[model samples]
Target: MRLPEVEDTVNGPFTMIWSLLLSLFASLTARSVVNGQTPAGLAPKAFLSLPLGTVKPAGWLYDQLVVQTNGLAGHEHDFYHYVSESDWIGGTSYYSSLEEAGSYWFNGMVPNGILLDDPTIQSQVQQFLDYVLDHQDSTGWLGPEVNTTKPRYLWGRYPFFFGAIQMVEANATLTDRVVTAFHKFVALANTMLHNGEGLEDWTRTRWEDFVIVLQWLYDFHPEGNEDLLIDTMKQLKYTGDPWEDVFNETYFPKTAVEDLRNPFPVLTWHGVNMAEGLKALPSTYRFTHNQSDIDAASKGWDLLFQYHGRPSGIYAADEYLAGLEAARGGSYLYQVIGDPKFADRVERITYNALPATLTGDMWSRQYLQQQNQIAAKNMTPNPFPEDGPYSNVFGLEPNYPCCTVNHPQGWPKFISNSFVTTPDQASLVQVYLGPYTVSTMLAATGNKVSVSVDTLYPFSDTLTTTIKATKAFTYYVRIPSWVTNGTISVNGGPSRPVSPTNGLHAVSVHAGTTEFTLDLPSEITIEERPHGSVAVHRGPLHYAFDISRSSRVLAQNAQQPLAVDLEFDATEAWQYAIDPSTLTFHTGTPAGGQLPSPIFDSGLPPFTISVAACPIDWAEGGNTFAAAPPTDPACTGAVTNITLSPFGSTKLRIGEFPTFKAT
Candidate 1:
């Protein structure tokens, strides 16, 4: 698709060079930029940030992604063909699957190939890219023209928006195609929105989707096309007024519990809407350069975290603002504002809610998952407001297929967005901790630096970063607030507690190789939850009650049964109360004291914790774990010892536990 080239409206090309040089020298560019500068002026350089395919997943994370590739992400196109409607990738109702496949291939398969140098994964990635580029329409629209005859009208083209972002990540050449398509679509969408005819139920609910992609394009554009980007932003309906209403009037987190009994419209309270909408205001902040817009984004998230925060650090929203639970959106928040708290939250969600909600093999997922969930089965009466009986089941389509396609994005994107460069392009920020490789261009020194981080993070407390750089550069490392006695040692330097500025521990590099060793102490902490219940935590990983389980294959395609689609039922009782005072933690292995095999395997956690507990009189309600544990449950038996496992490892285990006082 070829569209007329948009002219530069902001300034001439010489102005662009001057802006870049000024950014490097400007005193105001120090961690904080002057309030009203453009996002690009304050924006971290993308060249200085690691690309998606650079970092390859290892150990359990790699296994998870491969499982997805083998299952839904890799083979979804064979069973469900969305391109038939318009002979285009993103053409029919199944278009979301295509977007999911693109992200999965680019972020998962492509990167896996780079890390392992596997020809099979590499070939698959190239084939997908060719198909996408060759099939682009002349008008730039990737999907089918509006399906006017369908009963359910969704005017907002999410797959196109999502697929466009994937194209940006996949191939730079395809960006022009994406930009042109967006311009044509946005113009038509704007006309319809201005006349109050474009916004549909699902489209309005996810109106912020287009804004996020547009913001990415604007900052990415080397040429001065700010007007084209801003015009597209203004044209999108609800980009202005409706979203402002959410920032101001919609106290969803505060009122979500009350609204559960009396539900709100699903359009506003949907789980995915809340997850994706977290980026809406912050994305707009790029163009508006308004501090209020950014503030609103942070404030809204803060409220959501406070009122509806789950034990895993994911906010609650089942099908309709259920409660603090899974449908992971924590990483998106961290990406927006670069907050360490958000980064910590991302880890908690990634380690716990993300893997636990889906099967160990990453085949299926639960639509509504909670910190206290003990069962993953369909029920006549469930806790969720409007999800089906199969909402909690582990299957291909479970309750809704949205998660089948959407959930794979959680890990892949998290791995890709692990690092971001500062606005000056002199420093790099390591946000999410994991085993990966980072390659970036230091604009300040004109040096290309590559840092390889090797560690069993979340599972282990130590991380080693080995840097290969042309010259010296500053690397800003995140020191989580929970680590009071943490230390960052450079080249085996003296280990001492380092104070972080805005949660970042900065290290300056000299010419040649630099090695940094970070030690995070794992301390046992008991956190009090709703109704006098408590959650057990050791560093970032939460511990859950280890339970015996039995499985039955409800549905699956051709893949391995255990790896893809199946369901498990609790074979043992889960109604026990643990006494916090008797808690004793243990490392599973002796050599290096490393984690055991199958890091997140249910019933066989890598690490173990023993605690004295007694059977409780608590009962399940609405076929789910009781919303909150009984305030003080009566002990039913002797204080026998019980074994505990990491929250992510258990398939059907209790995370939040009822506490009983021992006499």
Candidate 2:
């Protein structure tokens, strides 16, 4: 079969006969490729991801997840099942323990399991898998029979769909079972949609979630004859509100800047829904290949970030699209399109907002994290649009359990997608800076390449990648636009300056082993945010003025008996303003400490900086932080020395600071 030759602007269109022949040729070629493994040496521009466990997290990334394993992701089953009433392994609730188990398996277990082989992680994963495989009904559903209570609510099965997909990606042995189950589920779902059985509101808006699973199956299904996949997509296509329509209008951008405080209409306001909604276009685009679909996806992101983006690079989703507070949305976008901007956004959020939202031990997390977050306490009229009063408080399921289960995905997914293979597997795309080892087959020569990266990135700017390949291949490294002085040294050769275009630096290497060192020097730049407040950033790491803080557990067994929730009280004055120009920085190395272990943690950070500043009179009140830094606040006291740490390092910090004139 032949594909219609795509013409450039200068070239004219092809004849109808030629187009038909080309289409036939392309279809046959696609069947050959998809029915088997995608042929090597057919590299596309970007966005094809490597399989799970392709890269093993190391150094800071590894340690961060270790802390997580000690916390929620590894042992949530000890407290309760995925759903509330269900016991340890299975439950009747459609979305509880099952959801948590699936996400934990995909995000936590498969990717990082080999690195940190904790018994609890291993045991729980096996338990969940055993239960799921054993309980799967003959018709294809993994849990619970169709009941009168929630008949036709297809949303609960999404976790199983996603989790099963990851299992197949991680271990091909599970593909047959997973695919068979999904096929059965889809058959049932198609009937329901056709008959209008039990499509709940969430099932409608969250239909894209189902489409995502179908697209994944269509792309990688072993048989590759998934005409049923097309049918499933059509069934789900009309379920959700037209996200493109709303995003195209003034709704997002207008509300983003003007009324960030007001609640959005029900359809658009939900945070997790918005995050999941980002996939609506790309999921559809995969089926239709319509340029408009891809275009709409990009436009949707632009409006989301333009109006609602937080300094941490995550959009605020404190239950709703709370535009200013940090939320988890960007990384999902990065997964869809291998855009370096999304990678950088993920890094910023992973380094700053992500860790800050959770406690040092990863025991608890805040539902909402503001740039100017001064205090993290429970409030009656909380800052969030619809979250509970304890939304800002650091605790297990403080506002809602969604974040409790969903938050674990942030770090693990970043690790899995740190580096991606181009579609044809000819090149490797370094999406984020981190220490890891990548092993994959290079399409250029059909030989395997293994790369190990060493660096204390985000905290430090230097990275060293050592590559061993059977044959030479190209490596594309992304250098952010903000980086001015970036250079790369090949095999200890002369350091050459790299002028990154569109945030990429492509290099060709010779066959055999080689080492490349990259040096990126960060320049401290202040960004003006909402209400004229300034945020300090060096590289991807956001810096904040450290405030003395004390914490007390407000409720024990609050959400569950084993879960402990804590509220923070600011011990020192938090309303000081500093002059950006007058700021002087002092660097310090590892201070030996016991608590906040693994240098990345706040108290024992691998590096620390002290800055000179003076206290200025800035007003502070309300359940939220001061709306904005006071305009020209008067100097309140003598100049003082204050320490500034990475935003992630600060449990109670003032990241967005008020600037005052020097006396």
Candidate 3:
């Protein structure tokens, strides 16, 4: 199923170059790109044209190294120092960004960088890795609980082992001690998975994640086990997303796909999180081809990304449920770092909502939410399994402390990734914004190119970059698959067409000038995931309507959650380009037209509609959730005012956009 061509009205040059980059990406590695999905590379393989970018790549690798790798805010090594982080893979904090981080670590493959680079931090990371590896039994299992502690647990040990190796590889540059340490850990991890009954801890489905990592390790260190590598992928295809309990209903309730005795635990999930991961089985299958793996991964992401794409480019997590009425659990940490589609999503969810939970300077509310569902701090003296909101921004208590420590990795890495160019000769300018200075480690010369970028971006369409190269080579630049009239030129000559007319994943490059100009036309268009669910968008920006209703009429003594007025276009103005008779979106809005955006981003604004409301999980100062409900925080009796606020504004509020249906 070919995607329809969107119009290229943004800017011509920028559009051309960007398209070229993405096209090259598609042509070279579309193997990973799912059929009917956009033509973009899901991993760094696409950036081969520029080796510098490939080896080092663009993004928070630098900042993440500085903060997370160096052990900022109590995170010694690997994800965090605690066990209870929630909302994986997106955001700046530690434990708070788990789900996404575990997944990202699998593909981003950057953890190895820390293993050898920071001696102090590496020791800490190695200690954790050593603990898991050494403690494993010969039957192929490692770790204390198979990683089943709320958000932090539950993950199979394969990814953790994989991350340990990745960190070792990256840090090996500094010391062979890193190599020996990682090798020792890998030996134990591999031994446990292959021969030990420990593999039983996780479902047969998660076997592939271990296989994938093993494959990578074996590829780099042929001395590693190959049998475990193949067996895991094989098992993953047959068994999918592992289950916590077969008989349990409340926790692992029989919902989405019941009837079948063994359903989900088949190496896939029900939404985009699982979709993109499993769909690539074909590419991975050849090593040991299994169509089932690809099928499972594809189906899942398709369902969620299509139905749950919030206005912010993120597939909203209504706590695993889909559609508009769902609550928000927006986290980019799980979104693959190699793919920037979710980078935009990460930006959206992390910026506004993530920061809103913190102090003005980013320290306060421990629990963060897109909806007002949960709005309390992680109360101290809280017990594990009893304390909910694994990682909140408020002060770190003993209970759910993962996010308190883990969430710290989000912001700095986001900033670093925002300006990516690794030891490889490649470059990926993830977002369109200004004030970000990008520095790339050129693979061609083992040198660096300092790029001072200054632009208003989304606000304006021009990006001015001062590229100071350490060597001369064909340097490529990206053109977001979305830009229409994008153009780039080295030293302001003239822009040439480098890519297709329309698409968000695109790129272009010039020969040798130090200065360059990238022009983008604001051909704002709304995008939708499959299933016809709409998320209002303009380029990478997802907009939302802050409903001040039930709270205030605006222009008053406003408490938290800022207030503002918005006017619609009146002429073609909000008018539908409809057949009129059909009453469909016709040419304008659709059933899900006014769909709300997810409010969460690394450095963006928060959307707090009103503090007047509360989520299902609520305690004295806020909301709480417990897998085991008997100990869960009880909500105060509702009565007078239940208000909603924008996702970005309120510390104690609900989503700015209330649940609404079109008139």
Sort the predicted structures by TM-score, highest score first. Answer: 2, 1, 3
lDDT of 2 by residue, 112-230 (tens): 45446555555555566556677777765556442235453677667656656665776788777778777777777777777865476666667777887776766667255366667
As a TM-score, model 1 comes out at 0.83
Highest TM-score, which number?
2
Q: Deviation in angstroms for 25 in model 3?
A: 34
Per-residue lDDT of 38-58 in model 3, one digit per residue for the tens? 222113222221211223312
Candidate 1 achieves a global lDDT of 0.60
Candidate 3 C-alpha error for residue 344, in Å? 5.3
Off by over 4 Å in 1: 1-49, 58-60, 80-139, 145-156, 159-170, 173-192, 195-197, 222-224, 237-241, 253-266, 324-332, 558-565, 590-598, 603-605, 622-628
Name the candidate that leads on lDDT.
Answer: 2
Candidate number that wins on TM-score, 1 or 3: 1
TM-score of each: 0.83, 0.86, 0.54
